[model samples]
Target: MEPLYQYAWLIPVFPLAGAMLVGLGLISFNRATNRLRQLLAVFIVSWLGASMVFSFAILWSQFHGHEPYQRTLEWAAAGNFHLMMGYTIDHLTALMLVVVTTVAFLVMIYTDGYMAHDPGYVRFYAYLSLFSSSMLGLVVSANLLQVYIFWELVGMCSYLLIGFWYDRKAAADACQKAFVTNRVGDFGLLLGMLGLYWATGTFDFDVMGANLETFVESGYLGAGMAAVFAVLVFLGPVAKSAQFPLHVWLPDAMEGPTPISALIHAATMVAAGVFLIARMYPVFEGIPVAMTVIAWTGAFTAFLGATIAITQNDIKKGLAYSTMSQLGYMVMAMGIGAYGAGLFHLMTHAYFKAMLFLCSGSVIHGMEAVVGHDPILAQDMRLMGGLRKFMPITSLTFLIGTLAICGIPPFAGFWSKDEILGSTFEVSPILWGIGWLTAGMTAFYMFRMYFSTFEGEFRGNEME
Candidate 1:
């Protein structure tokens, strides 16, 4: 009997259908009824839940057989060239599918209680479903072109979700900033893809992976030319993963809903870069100079994020910078040829980061209930303290997340980060030192944010 992996394409389809159903409410479906809204939520949850289950099945097959399952279909044809669309079910895709769907499902479940009173409740869930589909599509994509297509779709959904509260100017501006910033990376990606196609006449990842050396040598390309193409491709990951100058958009992204922040921080948007680099590891492995650039870029970005995070008074923005720092760790691992370590960190970070962001949302929700949701005090850590007494469960979960990110022993971050640091030690002690120093700073800032938010006296206006 054939394995169930061949049906991997359906993973994204279910969420897409859920998004479509929720969207129909805008026209004639009369979604305002509480009973209908509850049913829609149930339907969306079932689809995402199914996707996660299917992902786990593929993972089981992968470990048992060590064989990737693939299914391809012709998307378009021109002359002798063919554009294909399909699914690739490998260990990486299987892991990513589970991570994306799992985070999305949890966030959706949490949103019901968190966003219950919002006027745009139905629209919120619709966008969440759309975001889930976009991310899963990217995960199962069989080719670079398909990845690019879904990459842009993920960006679009992020833009819509970030500016979800359109009446607020800050939300609107943050959305514009994020969209425009990503375009910088996308432009380079487009150029690199066009060059690759011009040189090789095919956009399929498997084909390109197998024939890259032959294709590059066919043009008799020099080191400089090869480096240029590699760097251009690297730009896409840098921007999406929030490395260095391209990383400024992520902190401002806190203007979005906290659940959306968790999605972006954990599995969907930012993880895209690290995942793509892992998928195309062969290309980078061939270029030594490109690898060096990636290592130093990650080092500097990690330190920069740690420093900024230490100074941030806004709880969500502090966590945002921490995510940037963690992503840098993943990128540095990839640069040093520790592909497994990079992916390991990505997986562990997904769990803890999602927990951290959700806990922050819970904190904000409780505070809003107490203070009546004032715009002036929203998400400001300066106005939040002694929350642990009021929200012990949220505080405990958030504390666990802080410990995990700090690389404390017996925690997920400790395991993954140790691998990255150990991998760096073999390559360059200087880089290892940088990674170590950043780890210390990560612990400091994470605790600083936690204490400032949950300890001491109430920081909010006492009269309120």
Candidate 2:
């Protein structure tokens, strides 16, 4: 049998196959019986799930220490430049792959029941498979150029998934907004990549990091140029992570399917920004102004996202804004030089946010499943109350998510948030204070949204 490392490419390839299968099924069986469509959906999801599990098992057995493992296949090489396709397996990439694949599996499983009767079932599964493949490829990319290619692929997948229900104008609009906003940041990142290539003559992360000190000392790139490049690269992270003014698209993104929201918040779209920062931390650290800028932007965005989440009556939208706030905390941690803390928070956030979104999906699913219902009920929490009586499992899970997000002790969020805050103190007292205030507001708003959605008296009768 071939070694697992040699066949690592098959992991992402399997999902791409599933996507092709589902896409073909959609076109060929558009008018097919529901049973046939359901079978195809199950087949696609199952294949992707199996691939993920197999990849995880193989990776676990081969796990060593922090050093990255590379498997490169050359595509092109010329005098001083080389191009290749390969994977880089390190602690960070391994952790991200696990989080993304796990969340994708859960969401895919949940979709079977949640989207059982939807007409677009085949199309939905195809998009989900594509999204999974893109994200998996992104996490494993060996070079910055390859990473950028997969980065754009993931963004494209996000747009498709978010606009899956094209009949809904809000969904279409949200997709456009997200695509445009992220494109602006991507342009900055592209420029930064060009700058790095010009200065160091390489896009391989390891090579760049190894020679970073020499490049700086040779005056090929001064601190001012480094700061400019860092800020430009960071723009991509800010937009993708939903920090500050670029955050407008996220709440509206809740108009998409709940699973898409879960995917965005947990492992795919939003995480891209923080992943960039973590990937390029050494380069950013060389520029003092760039580090400070990251810290301040994160502080402001954290506070702003938390404050906005408090007033939203839409449960998923509130959670969306809250996701932005939590992401800001992660970015702030990276800005303060707490890479481990940022990643720790990212892992915990993935679990809890995914759980929260799925729980909300369950609630929405129930509301729409009332006997003999005609029009689907809205997802607005203002119209929902006393759901605990109907959805005990969902309510409990959501409660756990709420507490986790609020940074309550003993929960996952508490550990991560504390580390970020602790690290902030070493960077700046003002930033630490701002982070604390954000934490308090996060608690207040999350609980408010929770109580209003699950604890209050029933405000509307079940449709029949």
Which predicted model would earn the best lDDT?
A: 1
Q: Note the Cα lDDT for every prediction shown.
A: 0.87, 0.82
Residue pairs in collision within model 2: none
Pairs of colliding residues, candidate 1:
none
Off by over 4 Å in 1: 1-3, 30-35, 215-219, 462-464
lDDT of 1: 0.87
User: What local lDDT does model 1 show for residue 17?
Assistant: 93
Tens-digit lDDT track of model 1 for 64-158: 87677778899999899898888888888978888888888998999888778787777888899999999999998888899999999998999
